[model samples]
Target: MGLLNSLINSFSKTPTSLSERVTTLEIKTVCLGKELPDLEHLILIKDRFPRREKIKISIENETLEEIIQIADIPNFQQYQNFKNKFFDDELEVMITIDKKVEDNKFSIYCFDNFMSDFLKKETSDIMKAFNQLLKLNNYLIFEIFDSSLVPSLLLSTETMVFKKADEENTILESDRLKKIETCKQNSNFYSNSNLELIPEDFHIKTDSNSNLRNVFEKIETLLSIAYLSNSAFLEKSSFKIQISGHRMSNYECDINVQKLKNKEFYEIYKWTYTDGNPADKLIIARNAISLHCKNLDLINIDETVFASIKSNFALYQKENVMQYIDLKNKLAEYIVKLTTTSNDMIYGLFDKFKNNLIAFLTFLLSVYLIKIMSNQSVGSVFTKDVTYLSFLILVASFLFMIIGIAEVYFQKNKIVNGYNELKKNYEDILDKKDIENTFKSDDLLKKSI
Candidate 1:
């Protein structure tokens, strides 16, 4: 028992090294018949490699022809003992480079001359092999290869085996301890799960860049946020993961955590592109934002970020711009109330004066009818009563005219003056008020859309 314990300790302390170094690429091809053509041309290149290097063949099809063809192929010393393993009939053929390399140092050299030549030949062989392999299933078969061959091999279903660490001491250093420490410090990196109630009065301003930063920072800061109980409140919390550069895109990820722990933590990681570009950076950022909000439910995004993108779309469609107009008009309605109540009162006064002038015109016609119907001679009527009647009519008519003139004059003046007042106020007062219509809100929400 003592010797066994000592041996185990020694092995545990040893640096885990790669078992073998191998480069792998996949070829998907369809050949035209039941019998696959001679793969000799391809095998010759394989033969040129060191004979001691082991190559293994695994077939997906159970047909006798498929087995015969696979068996005819050369096997590496490492794979020689495993030749019978491929005889089990399946519909797929997987030829693996049976060399184990350390997970940390996996490399695929596609740009090399030898690899290029080998691929040229193997590409045809794979096509022919597929043709023979799929003769029974005459569906118009198409093949899709992975973008890179190296990672595919490393993660292949049949070729790779994942072994979880047996002992706690063997576990790789994780962010678990750090996340627990952050939660205990109570920095508000996030809401406490124990406090399930998001304060009802909590109205988070979606307008602050700092808010966005805080959300994203929280995702990175509280690693343990990931391990909480699956509550709806927890799911609704905004967590943000920012993907900044183009060099990191490609992998899709989800949060992983263990159950049964009183305190849980979130571990965030993503697969990014090795080849970096401006577009990739933008895509990464967008994808990260989407995933963060979508999956972990973290971060409050403001309209400014939303509108910056929206305005770009609106440039093509005028009708879509109505939303902006509506918002502005609403704000203008509030501004109108604040700046110009006296102007509205003046308008009301002008309206009343116009109504009185209309009634006075009706009275003039009645007076004229009364004069015509009277028994007085036309000349006398004009001579004796003309002065009084004319004076009275003239006075009344002139009063009505003055009122009309005054109403028009006041209306024009009010409009002009009111406009100037509004302009001056906007520049001097309301524009700086940090009100809804101020440039501050527009500037904040406009960037995102």
Candidate 2:
């Protein structure tokens, strides 16, 4: 009874929550520097719908009629009009298919709703159908949005290339692509690519094996591609990839990589103004740029490129002034520690000097008392055995004073040595030499440009 009630609830849509529910989902594939197979060829494949029992397939109305006419080849315009009307938007499932071809790119979008369990279950079947369509392409990305609303679930594939080196079943086996694979393995940010009902909330799951990790991994892989791709930074680069978008509407979230002509560098920016936290987005941008900097260093890129990266770092620091203040506080604390140690050392030597003076005064008092008790003059007290004892006391006091003075001298020397070391460290931290050198190099580069 409980299971039946849950199933009923899942299928039923509340009028109050209608605006919050996902109205559409889209999947896009981009083949970098390569053209993809035609939409007509994919749709016309007779055996593509082998698993028809799992999910029903539908095209737009006119395209459906054209499919019925076995002798006719559906033109691009016919394919555009053919909407997947199998699912009802108000009641049941509404599925749609659209294909786009622009220059060297090809794209496809599959749109559906959230109110049906059947639609959720059949997502894998839909992807399977699309996969068969896109199998001939070399580079592909499968991206989907859970809702049209803000803070929605975004699942996407990492930019992947189909390699001829491996068997046809293995699409990502190229040795040259190891860097991207490494980034994917290390990233813990994305949802799993497996087909499943989208979670109601965008909060990260606490479990280690959740789908969110897969989503993060895919994002990292994309970042790696942006950071490592050389052609992305070049001018008039002939090699470009094919990309697809929804025919019905633009993607809710997208990443665009462009080469900056003036700076001669690549910029990878995300186009999701509605869905993400601004701070998180800033962090993602900074991290991607940092990774790009490391890559630039490894390749021994031109000094001007590094200078631009340095300028970016300075800009970032300027934007977040609070972080710079915190850094200043840390340096101040280190200086205080050094000053405290120097004070302690100097004070210890002064304490030793005070003790030596006290001891010498006590010796003089003892000599005076002995002279008074024996009914002798101060001069007479210095004769015979008394004289010997007085001389011994004097020698001992002199020796004690000399040792204290030596110890003070040694401590003074230590303080001097410590101060010199501290000074050197301060000088290094505040050094303007490196800054001057960098400025000179940048000026030379600017003149050349």
Candidate 3:
């Protein structure tokens, strides 16, 4: 146990290099025979898929030998039977397939020489396309062969195994205690469960230089997140990781970097035990985002980190941007109110002036009519006598003007005061009490009705 502790400690303190070889890209999808497109449509798929080399479509039908273009197939969909598209015996990879023809699934395999072709930017497009191709959220696993630091064989055993220390076992226990103490010297280093989580977030910084082990560790973290609840899977594990409702840790997942240079690589520790859950949207989304981030080269990131980043994005957005929006909205609301009050005051003044002008003109016409009818001169008619209606018109015009002025004053006092209070409150935060809007004392607020 003491020697084992030493090996683990030595590995932790140093830098290690991981060599990656992209071995195989495996695609799994569930489709009915009819779901498979006709040869005419099928030949077009290669156009959508990646790889510079031409895609070969394998269909066991006598009518369509080799499909080069959709134009040549000529009514293939009308005559061809859907059942023959992926017969259980046809696909070599589906070893344990269902006997029923209706409930069949298949995997498509393709590869090129390890170096010259597979790692280019177009592979990113291919991953995005494959994500759409996946059915029922079943994942397409991308495998990269790696030299693991902890051999896949060791993870299943003795992870958290402990024995009672007695008089006979005092020496071994003391050695364990001392080594444990040394590791714990750095706070947050040791998990209550014996899993040794790395301190920093994983990043594949550049295509030329990046860590592959981080890739595996991240996937392992995701798988643990995805399937920690399945009791059957837990029983298979040798040790228990700390858990609450979802997998929780003292460590945090990083969301900064966007794309990885290499496809996701996980240690064979998972492959040795159980196949992961079939429909993990979390895993599927990560695969697509990694590809997207890679193709665009806008940023480099780990895919799983995106989940944490997105989950908390709404709150972060509200915190930073919403405050500004609220302040601006309050400012806008008050400004609109102030502008409406000024506009209404001007309109009321104009309306009152127009009404008075009409009334004065009508009084003059009536006075002239009465003077002509009674045979009196215009100057005498105005000074001595006028009709009752003409007199009422002059009095009403003056009253209307007074009422309009009063109403405008009433509104100016009400709306402008509200705006002042709002401005004062806002100034508490902005600290800009004495700032001017530059039209001088008629500062909109100080302007008379």
Candidate 4:
């Protein structure tokens, strides 16, 4: 009688223990657009639940199979629900699958507390078994959530690539951190589970679907702007003349060509750097386009120049030509002004140093003269009667040296303040206003179209 009671008690406790484990489990899956074996074709080989009780089955299938036991489950209906919800035409879904085990059986349930080492291990094992059973060639991403609904572990068979943070500037560093945080927040699996997952949001699909043409256009625009900004401060000797035009048949004289055979217009001939200064290939390509637009009338020209490059010269339409030129000239003038301001500040610094140097030299000379006058053999004029006068001269030289040092310090502070203001303005012009105006103009054009 005692042994029978003990066995019944153990059996009752098994279901409760299993139920606790199941309620804490959370599963997230990311399929890498790979074909999976039919679920109906899978054959259950074994069932081991909260108690680890394993049962063997004899069945034949195209692939090896196994069954995970969950407590308090009566049928396969719950599992089917999970599979149906995860299926997608685009082969991507971010969801949390929940199951509960109780009373020595398992059934699918709503998500509750998910934080558990045991649950994480179980989820991982299930994913691995599924991969093997389906003979999947691509890796699946898995994440386990804790009781607080926060992910405790993210496991994937594929390597993840992350953009490196810029360490040189505080603003860039902050931007990088924000980007990372945004990526995490908008992540397929981690985002608000209610939001429907889109294939474009997935990293793998995004890489494949990105528009290369648009990307190249943006690169070209940025390169052109960079070239213009750098050339603004270049010396005349370092500026190479880039002439592109056609010789008019009627006049037998070269006239500036505005349009190419392909209906593209000439924007601006880039001021190339002399001495073969390594240039951005994108900028070089822009310059080639400009030349092509200029020399459209020429019978024989290098066709290879247009080989792989897409012409964005059409973007520089006649309507926008004057505006573009005006913007460029304004930027150049701003840079030149900044250069002049910096030069003036440097000269002021040098002048202050020279003045201080003179004052210091005068002090040293006065001290040497006083020493000579005080020497009994060298100067009897500095006898007891005039000894006080010598002391006064020494004190005055010391005062002058102190005053000179103070003046230099004050002048340096003023120069530094001016330079700082100039630097702020320069950065505002180059970094903020220039890019802002470019994009604004582009946006305006787009809207007008």
Candidate 5:
């Protein structure tokens, strides 16, 4: 009787608490033909539904449910249309597969809004977590699918950024040609050629400058950028769009189909954005430029380029300012170190300047004394003017000694205080890993609340 009641509840159209629980319960056997060993470690449940061979999973939220239903289409065209109506709410995809031997059953997920934004900010973090999972699982595959929701603005025919941030030496026509050449070469040689150039391979020249074209070349070579169809740095407009995918293994490059054969683990794919709808090639070039800016020495920043970066990208501003502060603080410490000496060395050098000053004074005094004695012996050989000059010299020497003493004292005291302050601050700053761990723990707590 209990079994019959449970079966009835599972199939019910009307929502009951038990029915809701059943919806959330992962039907593992349907997805992973064999029950995954050590199920506790699984990030997503592998569920089996013998009756419903056509797989379905539901979330507690209705808005999300609608988004999933919209995205559930199997073809790229349908998914592209669904992407056009993107809203602010988060979207997650749940996959189901039919029973098959080996690993035939799998599902893929894409973020809606909130998660997309979160993962965008924490791209490196997402990669780290996914790689960890890949190491743990022994038999899964992961890949990032490259699908263009919209064309990029920077790479688009309507848009052109002509001015270099530094100065006005025009991006010459020849330079533009060279960039195109590089792109053509990249298409022929590399597997992940920038998507913009993918059309070029078919003899469709979406014409642009060489620098912009070269950006496409680099994007073609880089795994992450090639898949996104736009640069990660989207300035000039705030319109938000992103790309994402999941991996079945660590070795699998998300955008490349050729690398999937050897992968044997699962990886949650990343969400990336290129705002302003810049051309995919332009986005790639911008990223390379941004990376170059980061490696610049702290003491020398190109003011014009920096101004442009500050005006355009918020992330660049935060990162550069933090780096600048660290650089300034380190220089301040070096200045303090150069002025101070070890305690043992200090004892040997202490009063050394004063002693030198004293010796010079003694030698002058002796010369004056000799002149005075000679004048007494010879009567008019030394006059009153000579005596006055001797007195002036003595006074000047005393002043010199006083100034030297004050300089040494001030420098020594200043260095000692600076060192002590730095020591205290150094003690307060915990290990980098510990600091990051604390931040993660705090975030988890806040999310729970």
Candidate 6:
């Protein structure tokens, strides 16, 4: 009676509340001719019956059902759509085996979505979480949506993407040939013999003039200019389109296939605005370039693609600014060290002037002393005119030395203070000993001095 009541309630779509419990329940879309292991309950819906137990199932419709047994139903292969559900102590799950379409894919909602308690669980990485969910020509997508019913992510496996592309096939033969012709015509490097070219394999020739990191940057700039030759930057911001599968044709070079396979993907399949089977070979090859909007559990998902590009630019700007500042500070500190001595003496034009002034004063004093001792005319040697001029010269030299000293100290303090402030603000990026060594190092850093 208890089991029968559970089944009756399941048919009504009422889920039992399981609080503070999270367990993984994985189920394939189709399981037939046998039962799953270690399940408390199961249901094998043979087909969408026109009338099953007084319930109208006239038209085939997608459904969510609950099962109370684990054993596989007998002769489950011929069923148009079969659903199996079971509850272990931790999770309640169901498997839908729909043979209606050859491309039988499933969607697993990772969030609770106020729908059921089962999908409320969380994981760091969705790709790793459902790696094995797709098996035996079967594939599943992990989707996350918010309260507003907007998808945060629509992720799937590589196999799922390739198969979808295969189903949809390729673009029109004329379209492929036209794109190839455009590529060949635009690039001067492509000769008559090397006529075949496609957007995926086409690249701007690299120049020797490009600086360290500027080569890639220049390529990006040129590509953008060519693509946006007639259109404004954000002119079609609101336009949206998704290309579907098509008849087969080789629109791109064979090299494009290898390039796609060799790509290092930092993130999973991402799509926004437009999705489904790609119509272009390049689009089909590099899957993640399809811009995404909003955080969808995948890595680096942003609300706007523009926002993502802006963020990357900002990071690069910050890094370059720091490098320039670091180099400038080192030069300032070097000047301070080179100009000053161990005894706090600065070796410059001012020092030379001070030494020469002292020597003249000493010579004049010696002459005056000798003339007085020999009973000579001391008044002539130490005349009023000479005395006044010597006094003025002494005062001027003293003032100049004071001003020079002040200027040197001001610049030295400025350099030291700047380094200290930068180190304090970026403490996490520096080591404990970096404060003392920043200005002292003369060794070059990665093409920088």
In Å, residue 391's CA in model 1 sits off its true spot by 22
Candidate 6 TM-score, true structure as reference: 0.23
Find the 10 residues in a row with the least total lDDT in model 4: 164-173
For candidate 1, which ten residues in a row score worst on lDDT?
Answer: 196-205
Q: Estimate each model's TM-score.
A: 0.20, 0.25, 0.26, 0.26, 0.19, 0.23
Instruction: Give all candidates' CA lDDT scores.
Output: 0.33, 0.34, 0.35, 0.32, 0.32, 0.33
lDDT of 1: 0.33
Q: In candidate 2, what are the lDDT values of residues 100-146, reduced to their tens digit?
A: 32221222111123224213323323333333433344333322222
Largest lDDT belongs to which candidate?
A: 3
Prediction 2 TM-score vs. true: 0.25
Candidate 4 structure lDDT: 0.32
| Runs with alpha carbons beyond 4 Å of true place in candidate 5 | 1-317, 325-449
- Worst 10-residue lDDT window, candidate 6: 231-240
Lowest lDDT sum, 10 consecutive residues, model 2, at 242-251
Q: Report the lDDT of model 2 for residue 193.
A: 31
Instruction: Please list all clashing residue pairs in model 3, or write none if there are none.
Output: 257-300, 257-301, 258-300, 258-301, 259-300, 259-301
Model 5 scores a C-alpha lDDT of: 0.32
Model with the higher TM-score, candidate 3 or 5? 3
Select the stronger candidate by TM-score from 1 and 3: 3
lDDT of 3 by residue, 1-449 (tens): 22212222221322122111232222222333443444544445433332322222222323443222222243564426434543332221111111111111112221122223334424222223322332222122222122222222211111111111111211111122332233233122222233322111121212222223344334334333322212111111222223222332221222113222232222211221223222232233333443444444312334453444344444544563566567668766766777876887798789779878976897788777987899887667666345566777778877887888788778877876776676666443332422233123336566534
lDDT (C-alpha) at residue 235 in model 6 = 14
lDDT for each residue of candidate 5 in 1-449, tens digit (9 for 90 to 100): 12222222232322232211101222211111121112222212222223323445332223444432311233445334444444333333333333221221111111122123323432223323323322222222211111221222212211122221122222212122333444343322122212222211111135332433433322222322232222222121111222221211111133222221100000000111223222323333344334433555211223453344334545644664675566457745654454344342355445655676677667656766886776655454336875676667668766866876676677666655654454445333333443344334334223321
Question: Candidate 1, residues 211-271: lDDT per residue as tens digits?
Answer: 2223223332223222221111122233323332222212222212212111111111111
Candidate 6 lDDT by residue in tens digits, 286-360 = 222233311231123333443453354456457756965775676577455544532253456457676867877
lDDT of 4 by residue, 1-449 (tens): 12211221221222112221333322222231222223232222112122323212111112223222333342357445434543442222211223332222222221233223323442223223332322212222222222222222221111211111111111111122232233233221211112221111122211221222232222222222223222211121121223222211211111112111210111221222212212232344445545554645322234454442324333433434666566567655645664565466557657766776676567556655777776734445445745676566557766766776676567556645653454354342244545565445334323321
* Candidate 2 segments exceeding 4 Å error: 1-351, 384-391, 409-430, 433-449
